[model samples]
Target: MENLKYMQAIVVDKPIGPSGLRLVNDYPVPEIGANDILVQVKAVGLNRADLIQSYSKYNPPPGSICPDIIGLEYAGIVVRVGSRVVNFKIGDRVFGLVASAAMGQYLCTHSQTAILIPQDLDFEVAASLPEAFITAYDALVLQAGVKLNQSVLISAIGSSVGLAALQIAKLYNCIVVGSSRTPDKLKLAQNIGLNFGFTVESGSFVQSVLEYTRQIGVDNVLELVGGNYLKQDIECCSYRACIVIIGLLAGIKTEVNLALILAKRIRIYGTTLRSRDLSEKIELANVFASEILPLVKSGKLKPFITKVYSLKDLHLAFNDLESNKYAGKLILNWS
Candidate 1:
């Protein structure tokens, strides 16, 4: 490590949402472990978790560095690498998801999970990627084992992760069913390879999805909006279908039918990258780096970024995210 120590950070000062954040100029820089790398962060991707975490609704894994800093995704250049790190070196451009402490100029995370930023992509775009794409890829491909010609339903299709899942499903020539409250957002999903999309008013899309699938029901679901949406997910799934719950935008607790789940033999999974094991994170990073990221470089996949805000405008970005109207991600540029 260099003599440089303190770094600017956005600290969640209290359980009071974004208004409680404090932009501190002298937060102590985090130290790296033997298998870690220190990054000079350039930009951050604001996740919904950051909002909830601000109000103490979400918590990072025990012992995560700088837990009060509100961020999960970042892109930057590696400023230093630990003794046990081999894949990355100083000054290599990289981006990845960490548990916390990303809304700052400096971040330290396990090197195995850090992905090299493609030569053609900038920090802001790279920042827009890790959280959304990683979560979608893990849920749809790795956990669910989505196959070609499968029918997949992705809720909240306008959200960043939902769009990422939509694009991945399209890669397999799968028929995608998306539900969003806003018609314009559904149109955006349709443009980005959504096959059957309609407005969801009361968190019910079972009729539309089953009708489109010829009553056979969808084979897989990326259940981004939980609460009432999950019950509908079970109702619309084909026999033995997999439902990966990636978010709880609708709410947490819900009234789900055990009989429906049992009768359909539905397999439901809940996942989050924030507190996953290191081996799992490393595996996902490798698969994403090799299989998914190349498409972005070839111009086949576009990372959705609604806007980039200066670090000074983070407060505004928080409110924008809370509005739930943006089609994609809101980035905070630390540079």
Candidate 2:
């Protein structure tokens, strides 16, 4: 570490929930390894994982800079580059995901983990893109093999990841059907190229999805809500369809009909971006940089940041995130 001594960071003083977050001004700036770069954080994106980590319901994988800090993705200017790091130098704008401890004035991560931000992209919007966009892309495009003109159903369509899935699926000329408990959010999703939107009530939207696809069912389903929704997800999928389970917001345990899964040849994949190893993360970052970054730079893809708040008001931001009132991401302005 150079002469830079201290930085501000949010420490989980209580570690209970949103209200447990606290800010500290004199936290030591982390030392970077030879392959790492120190980022001067401009903004940080809030995710459901952040809340889970805050409450001790989740713990970051080993090697995280600070396990108690509750953040996953960040965007900022590169302030210091380690001796062997040549991919980025001082003053480069970059954005990427971290296992933990990104909600601070300075963060050190592997240089390969950071992608140079598009010149036209705002830091706040860039902050909102990494976790949601990367997860959506990996699950839908890479794992599910979603292709052009195929049809997809997204549960919890109002979420940040859901929105990112909607846009990416559309870019492939795929038809999108989305579901949300809130009617207004469904309507909003429809306005943004969603082929159809279902207001999920008592699990009735399964029939709506089937109807929308003319009883044939969708080609893929991004199953964000697990539990009871899994059975319905099975019902809504067509023969040979894939279901990527990215979230379990509804609950874990669920009853499934083995015959239906066997008969339809449905494939299910459960994925979590943060739990992966460093090498895997770097590989994913490379894919994102090559495939998605150009789209982002061309304005064909973008982050939907619904709200922005300062680090001091993080609890309020988390409250907003938990309320599910926003259509996309909630961001913290760290700059």
Candidate 3:
């Protein structure tokens, strides 16, 4: 990267449709801060948020240099470390998250936010871990404080975060039940240790969860599909159950029963990894490094990639994410 003038990247050149994305060879290579590290990105992971940002629906968080470049997580080698950075050096394998600008050949991120990628994981799987696994761990363990043997319900069980949550929840020995519109996805979740999997074909899964839990209701819910899913989550929640809202994929407007919420004394929490302060991101990264890294290194916790696409096939990657047929992450291989 020494004296390099520009780098290749996929940019949202036209923020109108799914095919609005295009590959450019001359996107300016990013610069590192005093505490940052310069990375040669090897693989990147796609999120629904990326497609939404390209369409001008959800803007990347503040301090983004290339809001037009859409990506949330990447895995690569550290080519340079900032002046104040001491933990990492050139050639260190790492993976981390960003508000935006991660789909490029090179990216700069704070050193504290980057997790060392172990030898057991390759760039494609490493790229897939940060956004999905970190988000699931942060929301379930750090934020929701889920405990062993607790009954948990995760909406959209086939989603990237949903699959990550299934594996993480089982690590705590939680009795996990998940809902998905796709039966195949539910089956996928079951194969990953989800205790019970149900389909919300009619937009409801309260009865299924209740019956599985013997009418006791779930103690925690990882709500990723919002909309009426929140209403069903509330109905299936046990007394004082904790429900953490992470995504609003299923429309934002939903008429939830405030009366039931009050009666059950349920606790509701909404979370997003983006738009967070730098300090908060560093804290979450540290938590992942200490608690989640060992499991990942041991192959007990792994990323479930739906498909791997080459950088030249950026359009197809976008279309696949938009189709939402996939249960796990879609990876863009740069190498």
Top-lDDT candidate index: 1
Q: Give residue 102's lDDT in candidate 1 (0 to 100).
A: 91
Instruction: Sum up the clashes in candidate 3.
Output: 0
TM-score of each: 0.97, 0.97, 0.97
* lDDT tens readout by residue for model 2, 129-233: 889889999999999999889999999998999989999999989999998989878877887788898787784577788878999998999999888899989
Model 3 TM-score, all chains together:
0.97
lDDT of 1: 0.91
Q: How many residue pairs clash per model?
A: 0, 0, 0
What stretches of model 3 exceed 4 Å from their correct place? none
Q: Please write out the lDDT profile of model 3 over residues 267-306, one tens digit for every residue.
A: 9999999899899999988888888888888889987988
**Model 1 CA RMSD to the hidden true structure, in angstroms:** 1.2
* Candidate 1 local Cα displacement, residue 96, angstroms: 0.6
Query: Which residue runs of candidate 1 sit more than 4 Å off their true CA positions?
Result: none
